[model samples]
Target: MTDAQDLDIPTEPLPASVLTGFLGSGKTTLLRHLLSHPEMDETAVVINEFGEIGLDHHLVAEATEDMVLMNAGCLCCTIRGDLVETLRSLYRRRITREIPPFRRLVIETTGLADPAPILQTLMSDPLLVERFRLDGVITTVDAANGEVTLDAQIESVKQAAMADRLLLTKCDLVDQDRIDALTQRLAQLNPAAPILQVENGKTEPSSLFGCGLYDPASKSLDVQRWLKAEAYEHDEGHGHEHHHDVNRHDERVRSFCVTYDVPLDWDRLNAWVDMLITLYGQQILRIKGILCIAGEEKPLVIHAVQHVFHPPVELPSWPDDDHRSRIVFIVRDLPESLFQETIRSFNEE
Candidate 1:
């Protein structure tokens, strides 16, 4: 009974972390300082307002309204029916445990939300893509008008080109010649996240959760940095990027793939990758994939950002076996026809 009891490994605990930014960029003052620390005991917030999930989080006495508003807080504005009914009511209260078995799930989008169609409605939700696993996207940049709010906002430069950690908040109202030219314009706009600064909204939950999801061998949350954001690099050119006419923030955020040989149904292939990044997530900036649904043996990865998505990830095997479901997107003037109409509308659903 020792090779780790032969081989089971899934104790049950890894799912939360979404939090985005743009409007005043502080994200509820860093969720009131991470619900007063102690590693956010039993954390489970949802707060997405503009239509529903918002109530000042009951004056944040450590949050809970099961909030998930969607009348405008841009989670791809009315995308595939309010992101599949807020992920089927947060995965049916997390599988009949009926709430509170939670150890994580802090959603919080809304400042014109677009965390890639709410991380592809939590990675192509068929039912929260095999329990739940995508813990990356933590944006929030401001550092006193974050470099002219990334040049008068393009959804604050697509929330800093779909971040994985950019924090930066106020920084004592800027002045080290404006926080060194806003940290050299965020290292020329995201050179693979890791830019923390914060001052008023405070920082440190281990510099906001270990990226790569969170897995120092099981501290959890590392789906290869929310599905390997092509190991990162977007250089800079976003004037609200276009695509085909070219402008993945001024070029080369390229990552292309669109396989098939069949096996889809996973929520109409995430509603055509959330209506093709809600009509070009500002130019299909960075998308990721690895799906192979149908009967499900292993392989179901999907990540997005022009329409804000990041949730589907299911792999218990076959990092190789050529199962076939790969999706990789990254855009700029739509061409691969919404990635071939998002896997041919999952064969007409």
Candidate 2:
């Protein structure tokens, strides 16, 4: 059992992770393997259609009309209505003892769906926000056909870029050279996210869960682990020439890290972030960082999906000795120099 098991009976807000990937990327297969684990028994899964997953093999008992208790003790539910309503209903049932009191949640999105909308939906809803906090996004990428998928569908590229954890699935079907190439590409696409090679969707639940800024078991902010800004420091920003020439649309997408050596002014930082998102919310895919505020001794952690920013939280103390602020951004057609200049101006003010 891992730290995720400590959350079996959530004392505070439960963490919810969004599982997204392209068609045939093995999301369902990964999810099925996760549910089969005894440690994942306390988790609840929400999907669009029950028929699509074919979970009858793991069926244990029916909890209600739309929800079922799985053989390993997870509660599986189909969306009764809109996502907001479905999540609300699940919360209600959990409190009322209508279903198992699952401590964590995993929402599976459709292959072609843009995950930003789903993240925004959860953030906009006050009730959902109070009951659940985003753990992180777990995206599955097929090693066999990931390159083709990314070339053909812009949505697949977004899915890979916005992920907090990238699961490289079907690696057994591809050669080392292909896997190596795809791995390098994924790193450039999302340097902050950790890529885990998964064969036949076989992966431990521990590796996929608890990827957010706050680690429940540690009871503190894990800034370095969450940010992984070091990845960007190592990136030389090369190799996009061939990709850019082939797929102009994906070439516009950029992932980079911006840093400030001095402590950031709270007021100015807020204004800068507000203006950036207000002007280019649709273009921005994900934003996350740990800040060293001017007046605050402890570091502040922030995360956002598109225009919706999670309320910034302050840690009791710094995660480590390093105190410089680092912010990572995944955006489309947004110039890095623009971000650097804007923030630089705000800092000067």
Candidate 3:
């Protein structure tokens, strides 16, 4: 919440939300409520249903045929063919103007699905990485059963840890003391996410969204918060903040900005972007920067949503005389070594 005078507001497109949770976490109920919002009418939904019956579709009444259902149920396991192929087809439809030009796409992953692999598909796939932007991740927790679920189910813990927003549903069923204790435990698990209450699938959409790459209203981007938890309001657990587990995607995403003193060789910069976006772009959730090269007074801006990066934009004038290229990256399961190695390799050339 910087003051207007100090803020460097952004002007970019908003990414869609990725809602996930364990079974009975009320993810479908939340989606049903979200889709009911007048603002969500233009949103296309992709639901991953796990069971043979696949009754989740019947639960969502707002979406038309716009809802695409994946039969395998888990995104990580199904995406190699089913997930990737389906998303690719959807991309063509959107770009070719075949569909209603959905402003947002909500991918509702199955309760048991792991998010990292799904994120990987979105980032690695050439057809998708650039075409669709991952807005944010929202995870719902059963207020009454969360502690037990977290204790017994490691996947639920992972889901909660990675979420940008944590919704505690069934609040009416739990007492105040129990809710307070649950919040305390959740703080230890993942304090970076803001906790919101939901009863009967009713809550404000605004509180649940805009936790992604760019802030729609301000247009200003905060890479730290988007990839990691810098944008969150609280940090209660020192252990969770420094959790060093290196699994495919354990909510320990980290982000930082790099500055260059000299104006970059446009060709070199482009090459770096190409190599990184191609090699590990899927690992990189978001990348953006303002380039200040030697010859140009105005900055060259680069932005990427998932792996689909938009073309660079040359600003009308220099925002300031810093004359340093500044780029920020939101990377998941990415070590600082990757950035170091990339920089060293780029400079040796």
Residues 1-349, candidate 1: write the lDDT tens digits: 2343343323553565688888877888888788788877666676766664555565456445444444444565654466666656665664444555555667777777756666766666665656556667788888888766666556666667667788888888777898877665664455456677878787767667655433434533344333443333233775333333232242333434566767887777767666666766677767666677887876666665555575554555654456666554555446655566656755663
Q: What is the number of backbone collisions in each predicted candidate, taken in the order shown?
A: 36, 0, 7
lDDT of 2 by residue, 160-215 (tens): 89888999999889899999988888887888888999988889998888888886
- The TM-score leader among the candidates is 2
In candidate 1, which residue ranges exceed 4 Å CA deviation? 1-140, 147-149, 152-159, 171-197, 200-202, 205-207, 213-216, 219-262, 265-284, 290-292, 302-314, 317-330, 335-337, 340-342, 345-349
Query: What C-alpha lDDT values do all the predictions have?
Result: 0.62, 0.79, 0.68
TM-score versus the correct structure, for each prediction: 0.31, 0.87, 0.65
Full-model lDDT, candidate 2: 0.79
Query: Model 2, which residues run further than 4 Å from truth?
Result: 1-10, 49-81, 234-244
Model 3 residue runs over 4 Å out of place are 1-14, 215-218, 222-349
For residues 1-349, could you state the per-residue lDDT of candidate 3 as single tens digits? 3344543222334266778888899998888988889988778888888866567878887346568887654776854468778776765565555666676778888888766567656655666655665666788999989877876676677677657788999989989998997787665455456788899888888787777544445545443343332332235653225433344233445555556666678877778778887888666765657777657766776767455666676666554445567776656567755765676567555
Ranking by lDDT: 2, 3, 1
Cα-based lDDT at residue 241, candidate 3: 54
**Which of the predicted structures, 2 or 3, would earn the higher TM-score when compared with the native?**
2
**Better structure of 2 and 3 per lDDT:** 2
Give candidate 3's TM-score. 0.65
